[model samples]
Target chain A: MAALGFGLAYAGFLGLCLAMDRHHAELLRGRPAAGRRWLLRGVGWLLLGLSLLPCLALWGVGIGIVAWLGLLTVAAYSLVHLIPYAPRLALWLGPLLPLAGLALSLAPT
Target chain B: MKQGFRQCMAWLHTWSGLLVGWILFAVFLTGTASYFRGEISDWMRPELHAPAAGGEPAILAIETLKRLAPDSPTWFVFPPGERNSELRVVWRNPPGKPTPPGSRGFGNMVLDPATGEPVTARESYGGEFFYRFHFQLHMPPLWGRWVVGFCAMMMLVAIISGVITHRRIFADFFTFRPGKGAGRSWLDAHNALAVLALPYHLMITYTGLITLMLMYMPWGVQAVYKGDRGGFQAEVFGVAPPVRRANQPAPLAPVGPLLEEAMRRWGGPPGRIEVQQPGDASAIIRLTRRDSEQISSNPQTLTFDGVRGTLLGASGEPGAAAATRGVAYGLHLGRFASPLVRALFVLSGLAGTAMVATGLVLWAAKQRHRHARAGRAGFGLRLVEALNLGTIAGLPTAMLGYFWANRLLPLHLADRADWEVYCFFLLWGLAALQALFWPGLRSWATQFAAAALLGLLLPVLNLLTTHRHLGVSLPAGDWAMAGTDLLVAAFGLLLGLLSWRLFRRAGRAPVTRPVRGAGLARAEGA
Candidate 1:
């Protein structure tokens, strides 16, 4: 049950993070293309909803999501590092990796 | 003071963080492991490896107390429960040393829960040592605690100053560029980790200070109560009860029933047993922690009259002052939380450790790149590099040595655990010496390998020295032993990998370009 909650939360978290990373990248690299703006914004806000309650609860399930999120982010990070042309992974997964890492640590193993 | 807030904070953050970084790192690492301190103690001592049943803890406490402190002035028995297996009973029998008996008191561990016999659980002062050392370190007991209290205060200041120093706080959110010229990466890591759980950092630091605030500002009680520590304690928080002198000697009242009552009241097992006198005229018994709301699980003591063991009214909690203090301490310590929250704390702790490591490395990298650009890494740069290597690797090497001493030292030997701990410092001292002599890549690699090798082989070392092994331990559900072995293996693997990587990284030519990209350069002036 904790794992499920953690997963749902992390899934949304990851999606949101992806959009944020893109937004960050666009700023750093100068400007973002016009049409793609909504994708990340919509996803990021949606992820917040998934995480909103569980984070407040700060229970096993919440930590589980956070942990799974960390693992996923690590995976996404590895993908970014290992696979060229997957800059998109960084765009999406970068923020979540660290945030999830922090959240996962909210409970003891 | 003369400078702007940003400049002053920058100075404060750097000095404070650097000065305390080494010790703080050690504290964080040990504290993280302390979650499994009991398990470590269990693994360190193979004979008493079973998870003793909790149903009989109260019984064990009663028995231990009856035997150990039949006529002590006071008794402090740590009741056995889910958290720890050992049955420890402490008392103050004073004449020579008038002060708090502190560490020196009659102490024994109930070896086996099944047999109700004293099993030889190799005199390991391993787990609690770190817990004590975490705050007080190895200095003079009370003074050490005060020192730790002060550092915690400074840490709070540093954290605040760091936040102020970093102007682009929100702008540079989620920034880290790996393999950057070390300085930039260090700053990024420092910012990232510090900011990631900024609230946690601040809370921990603040509460840590608050926990020992009494010692730091002893003048508050001292001035008000005119040096009456006890009176101040009773007045301020009402946790520590007042001492009563008994004129007439009476048989010590039975504690088993009181504990039972407290347990009935509190709902959970009575976590601890506090008796004013072992077998005296004035012996007040306070039984606490049976059942309480999750909001505040303070050791709700059910005090008893000294002579009759008659239940006294439930009292204390100086109008929410003590309760406030407790909640702050509990939340910071994670003692009140469910197991899951503790797990999160541990994860964050590990990440925090990583954060420090990354930051330290970044500092070195920045210095190196700067030196390289200047075409000469000077004497000072060289010295800083050596000091970093020495402290970072030396501390762990010392820890490994401590474990080895625990197993190798004879049980009959006096002050065995003390020696074991001393060996850690001794080894750490040697590491510093070695760093000075070598002053290069070779020393780092060698010491790291040495630490890792020892850590990885810790289980094997235990097996060879004692009858404990994986086969016997695993099936028996001796998670302590199994966990210790697994942790050792993990450390070994990590160290081994690090050693290899260090070797690989050493071979690569230094890069002149700052490693900033991927949002790491947000705040830095280009």
Candidate 2:
């Protein structure tokens, strides 16, 4: 559940980063159009909101909110460090992490 | 006026941060390590390798305490739980009896719950030293706490002023240019570290002050209780009044069923059991709910009549003010957090430490340029540089030295715990002396290299001196032992890289970039 939350946060931050001019230029090698930027921003906030579900499910409302905030920080820190050095790997991990988390959750203990 | 306001905030941020940066670094680093305090202590006591036994720990602990200190007025029994592997019991000496040597009027022992026998581990403070030093700083209790509290206040001021002073916090949120020139690189690193964990930094600093609020601001308590501190404590913390002994001797009822009942009520095992006047007709037993089971440091205790094994009372839910205080205290301690959340706390702590380190170095780097242009280093800049070197690199060396002393010191040595602490300060003092003599990049490199050596060699020393090395522990699934070794080695690798970088930088040409009013530029940039 924590991994799923972390993955969604990472992916959400990635979307927000791509919406910015500087990061988008560095990672995508082109400037994002106005419509594309707005679309990215909307999706980013949506994904971040969606990420709260796993945390709320894992812990109750009180602690889950705190855990979600911490997970967001971790995800953002990872993205900030990786975007500079390993942008492709940073992007790849977003999808891969959630898939891995899903497989682990479904597996028999 | 706007510009003047920001400049004033910039000055406040710089001075506030620099004044207490070194102590803040130490506090942050040690506090981070304390998240794994139980694991570190377990690793230090290698003789107690077996997992907690299936039998009732409270029963075993009570049986041992019955034999060990039968006449004592009070007994504190901490039964083996998730964090600890042995049942620990402490008993206060009865009146008119000579206190046990080295025990300070109390007798304590670590008992293997499986057999109810004492485990003969070497005397060491282990992770308790870091946990204590985190807030108290190893000084006399009142003095250390006051100094740390002052620094925490300064840190809070710095954080708020820093946010106000920063011109482009969001724009530079994800920016980090390590390969840039010294001033720019350090500033970027500091900003990134501080910003990344900004929420954690704020929460930790605020809660740290709240933890020791009574000491810092006693007026409220004094005004309310009129010097009756005990009354305030009893009311706020739900501490039951002390019971007088009946003098008539009586066999205490079995504790197993009582423990089971308490556990059933709390939905978790009790963290501590307090037996007052044990074996006496007026005996009282209080069981405290484990910290891990709730997000409040305020304990929920159930009191039982020890002789009859009947429930006396349970502490009711705390009032609004007390509950708020309890949650704040709980958030600061992070005891209720899961392993994953605890890891996040540790990471945020490290980020805070690094933020302080970079901020200090940034000040030195900015000042050195001005001093170079003036053709001589001033006394103040030199002093700050030396102190920064001694604390940043020296403290880790001392911590590792303490761990080494735990392994190398003989088991039967008198006051072995004190000796371990002395070894820590001895190493730290040596580093400070060396830095005082040579406060330069070379000195920084040397100290970091030494720390790297000590950290890397610890696991090897453990293997030579004890059976609980990585080789044995990893295969046996003893993560407490194996994790400590691996974590130290990882830190060793990091310090090694840092030392190599400084050494390489020192070997190169003196990179004296042109100073365009470096101090003003920094004030403006910050």
Candidate 3:
């Protein structure tokens, strides 16, 4: 569950970053302001928020929060650096991550 | 004298970090290993590999105590936790009891709870040595803590100043180029690690100081507690220590029932059992809950009258201030973390160690670059190089030596633990001497190769000595043993790779780069 949370969080953060004018132009071959930036931002926030569910499901609230934050930091850092080298992979990852996370979360413990 | 604040911070960060960099590296490495301290201890004591009894440990402990120390004033029994496999028992004399001059005030031994027999595990320091060395450096207790506390303060300063000095920290977070000139590569590595885990670094350092807050800054505690350290402890932990033992003799009640009661009250198994005045009329038993069930490090304990197995009372609940302190200690110790999170903690610690190592190397590389332009290096650069190699590579090599000594040394040798520790220091000293004498890339490769050799072959040695190889351990589900061997092998591979890299780079002349800002010579030359 925590692994799923980390995956979803990383994906969500990547989506939000790509939605920005700079990252969008660099990675998507589009005007930075052209994509549904607000929509991406909104979805990113929702996914990031939703990632906490798996964490809370695994560990109780206090430890879950700590784990979630740690996962968030690790994911955000990795996604930021990963975007430059594999922009296409990074773009695809933003959507595929939550699906993978969902599959992992529903798997029998 | 008229430098900008950022430049001043840069200067402070470099010097302060460099000054204590070696010690900090040692502290970080040992501290990182300590996250698996219990498992390490288990691996070191191969003889204590008996399968679990799957019976009530409380009953086993009571039976063992009855046979071993029937009249001892106090008996402390520690059942195996999720990681440990041995039950530990300690018997202590009452207050004012006469003791040998060098006695530790108690006698303790590991027991196979199944047979209720004392374990004949080899006498070695085990993981406790690394845990202690993290903060104590194995020196006199007070001085060790003082030294560690001072280094921690310097570490905090270095972290803060480092952030201030790295003006392009955010911009450079994505700018790691590994195959560049030595200085740039080292700087990039240091910056990436430091920034990537910046929050963890800051939190660990700050909480490390907090763990020893009373010793480092005792004025507030002293004033509030009126210098009564015992009182302060009692209030914080809420343990109502037993009074003097009554001389009247009385048999101890069955501990199993009391343990069951404690588990019921605490909603979990009791982590530890402390028996006070075991054979006296006023005996008491205290049961503390396991740390895994809570975020705070402080265990909630319940006390019972030992004679009738009746509940005396529970310990005091921690106040807000005490709870905050407990949280800080918990975060630093991370005893409550699951296996995955604990592994993460170890990674962060390794990252911290890497950060310190790179910072030290960066300083040396820059100086060498600056001095090489003048056709020679200075004494300071040479010294830093030797020290860096000695510590960065030497420490791990020494650790490997310690493990080798455990396996190779005579099992019946007296003071075996001391000898094991001596081997560690002796190897470390030899590495330092080798570095000093042979100084350069050749020495680096040699030291790294030696460490690699020792680390990679430790499992084979263990197999030869105890017949407990990974082949046997892995299939048998003895993870603690197999895991240790596998990790050591992985570390060995890393060192081997590093040794190969150094060997390849050895032939090239020092790579000299332009000195920037104040001629700090902070760029890599070779």
Judged by TM-score, which candidate is best? Answer: 2
Which residue pairs of candidate 2 clash? none
Model 1 stretches with alpha carbons more than 4 Å out:
A8-16, A21-39, A42-46, A49-52, A55-109, B1-5, B49-55, B94-111, B115-117, B236-257, B278-282, B290-297, B305-310, B315-318, B510-526
- Candidate No. with top DockQ: 2
Q: Name the DockQ score for candidate 3.
A: 0.35
Candidate 1 docking quality: incorrect, acceptable, medium or high: incorrect
Chain B vs. true chain B: TM-score per candidate: 0.85, 0.94, 0.94
> Candidate 3's residue-wise lDDT over B1-526, tens digit each?
4358888999999999999999999999999888878778888889986457566766787778888777777888888777777688888854577766656778788988677678899998888999999999999999999999999999999999999899877556545555677488778778988987887899889999999998889998789988988888887898775568788888888888887787777677787898888877899888888787777787688888888889888877789988888778888887754877776677788888889998988898787676766766667777787789899989999988888998888999999999999999999999998877766676777889999999999999988988678888999888778888988889899999988887777645444341211111222343
Best lDDT among the predictions, by candidate number: 2
Ranking by TM-score: 2, 3, 1
RMSD values for the candidates in order, in angstroms, are 6.4, 3.4, 3.7
DockQ-based CAPRI category assigned to the predicted complex of candidate 3: acceptable
State TM-scores per candidate.
Answer: 0.81, 0.94, 0.91
Model 2, position B146: C-alpha lDDT score? 97
The DockQ scores of all candidates, in the order shown, are 0.14, 0.63, 0.35
What range of 10 consecutive residues in model 2 chain A has the weakest lDDT sum?
A: A97-106
Better of 2 and 3 by TM-score: 2
lDDT of 1 by residue, B243-356 (tens): 666656787776667766776776666666777765677778776663213434445667887567789767565467777776676655655335555555666666666655
